[model samples]
Every structure is written in structure tokens, then in C-alpha cells.
Target: MPLLKVVYLSNNTKLYLWKITEDFDMLFSQVKLKDSSLARLESMKSESHQKGFLAVRMLLQHNDYSDFDLFYDEFGKPHLKPQGCSIKDVEISISHSNDFSAIAISDSKVGLDFERLKEKTLRIAPRYMDVSHLKNLSEQEKIKKATVVWGIKESIFKIKNEEGISFLNHIFEEDFSFEDKKATAKLIFNNKEEKFQIQFDSVEDYIFVCAFEDVK
Candidate 1:
């Protein structure tokens, strides 16, 4: 169980990260999964994706939940089945990159994304983000920031889970320095505006971003 880190985002929210160090068989034998999850896992075409799926279940069990307590809505958003011992609603978001799997559980609406830093994200930055944000930074710093911004958009999208959201045209992240380790973003779509608070950090060579909807 390579449970890399546990981050307490707030009193009601926490983020869990796992380093996928086990082989597929080892992971499959260790965690319990529901029939639907087993079927879904078998449907994944890649071994890496299957492992990532298993790793998410590992994190859920780490938090005392299981695949049995998780389900997907019509929009494909993941939700936790409420238990009598806990709160009425628990929001969850999950992400996976090449070597890491992450999940954020919160009492409020939240979203999360995990991305591996790469030159492709840097090259494609202009497509989905404000290029001005990458100015005056070294190449390495640019990749880091751009990856975070991309993750920011993805996290917000997971939270909104509505149709017609465009990363390039709809999500806007406010200017912030990398040292801040956090920022804010706005979603403007369908003639409505909503704000989100974003917190991001690096794990090894990957970036993890978490988004929480702003309280009115």
C-alpha cells in the first residue's frame, strides 16, 4: 500500500494520493469490489487504467468506504452512497495519471484532477489557457504552471458536470504566482457565473489540483 500522502484540505474535506507500486494481480487480490466495478475494471482496455481503477478503490477503503459505497450518476459523476453513521451527502472526485491515483472527499461540492507534467502540456497550453500566464517564467516553471492551470479547468469541469462546458472558452483561472500554491477560477457558461477555489500541489513529477465551489 503505497499511500503516498494524506492532505487535510479542510475540516470536511481531505485528499488522498496513492503511488501505484503494485502489480495488477496484487491489487485485484487485496481490495474488494462490487460486481459493477469488477465488470467495469474488465472493460478497461489498458493495464495501467485497470490499475488506476483498483488504486482508487484502495484509497476508498483507506477512508473506510468501498466500491459498494460508490456509484456513478447519469452524468458519470462519482457519488458515495450515504451511510446512517455519517453525513447525508458526501461528494467525491477522482483522478489518475501514469503513476498516481488521487481522490478527494468533501462535504461540499468538489472536483479534482491529476496530471503528469510533460512538454505536451506546455506546447498545448495556448489551446486551453491564457498564454499570458506563462510569460516571464523559465521553461520548467512554465510547464508546472500550465499543467496546474489545465488541471484547474478539469477540476472545475468535474464539479460542474454540465454539458457544453469548454475548457478554453468557459473556465478562467485568475492570475496567481506558483508560490501561492492556490488560486481561484470562474466558470462562465449558459449566461451564469460561478466561482471556485483551487488548491494545487506537486507529487513527485505529477500535479494534483482540487476545486471547491465557493460558498455564497
Candidate 2:
């Protein structure tokens, strides 16, 4: 399928989702990949991974960019080359799971993470998040909320893109209602603490979360 949905997280930030329904050959034919990307694609052991990689390129092209405009930093975070003389610097974060790939672009620092709801996430919740938040929730609701918390931590890590940040020891998500679809979190690391604004929602059995540095 084509671009599944476009979500405007804020005035300057937008999230794009692509549902993967096309075959590897079809997807591969739709986008132009840099030689290095092609090599990386060829090295992928799973066809699903190859399709997800190509789908992200497809998303870049949808926004008037191509593989050529993308690069990664030493920390392995994806970055988009400056579009031109535009004054606004664009930052991006990417995530793909099972059958959907997502990208978030913003004028300021941002992070994005997508995850399919799974029972295992709830079972492993104590290792990474505050299990107290799961109190009073039904089993299914627990799974969904746990997945959101997982995405929240992953998203924040993507923004910091730093080494030695532990989700369990360093990241803390504020308690939130599943209906609210949004929350706040804090990262305490390296003798300092930083805050982030979080937005999340359920999308066809998956939870996508975005985090922005709290400038206030």
C-alpha cells in the first residue's frame, strides 16, 4: 500500500506512516537507493526488513527527498541533509515494526518509535518501566499501555542518541491514562535531567509515539 497516514504532532512536526503491502521487488523498483543502501538492503537476512527499509525511502521521496538526501551520524541516528538555504534545520527519527514503517520530521529535536501491541511487552514491563502504572488496568489494557511506555522510552533514547542511557535506570514516564493518548517523561542521566513531551495513539493494533524536547 501507499502512505497510510500523516499525523501532525504539532505546528512544525509531522509523522508519516507507510503500510507495507507490496512485495520486495515491487517496493525495490519504486525508490532509488544509494549504492551503500543497496548493499545494506542486500545484506538484510529477512525480506520483511528489506521491504521496511525501502518503505522508508518511499516516505522520504513523498516529502521531496530521496536516499541521496539522507545520512547517518556517528551515533547511528538518521539525519536528513539540509534541504537548501532554508533557515529551519530538519531533524528526523525512524522506526519500523512488523508491517508498518514510520518517520517523524520536525524543525526541532524529535524522536519517533512504533511498536505492535504484544503480550510480551507487558510481561517484561518491570525491566524497563514502572509497573505501578499498570495497576487497575485490564490485562488487554495493560498490554497496550505497556507498549506505549516501551515506545516512549525508545523514542526518547532516539532523541538523546547517547551511549550508556538505560531505559530502566535512566528513563521515567509519568503516569498517564490510556484514553489521554499523551503524557510526559523525564530522562535522568549523566548527572542531569531533561524533560520531554510525549504524544501517542493506537493505530490499527500498533502504538506510535513521538517525543520532543521540552523547551519550557
Q: Each candidate's TM vs. the true structure?
A: 0.97, 0.98
Candidate 2 lDDT tens digits, 6-37: 99999999999999999999998999988999
Model 1: residues with Cα > 4 Å off, grouped in runs: none
Supply candidate 1's per-residue lDDT for 165: 96
In candidate 1, what are the lDDT values of residues 57-161, reduced to their tens digit?
Answer: 999999889999998989999999887787676899999998789999988999999999999999998899999999999999999999999999999999998
The per-model lDDT (C-alpha) reads 0.93, 0.94
Q: Model 1 — which ten-residue stretch has the worst lDDT?
A: 81-90
Question: How far in Å is the alpha carbon of 19 misplaced in model 2?
Answer: 0.4
Candidate 2 stretches with Cα past 4 Å from truth are: none
TM-score of 2: 0.98
Candidate 2 residue 118 Cα shift, in angstroms, is 0.6
Alpha carbon lDDT at 7, candidate 2: 98
> Candidate 2, after superposition: displacement of residue 178 in Å?
1.2
> Best candidate per lDDT, number?
2
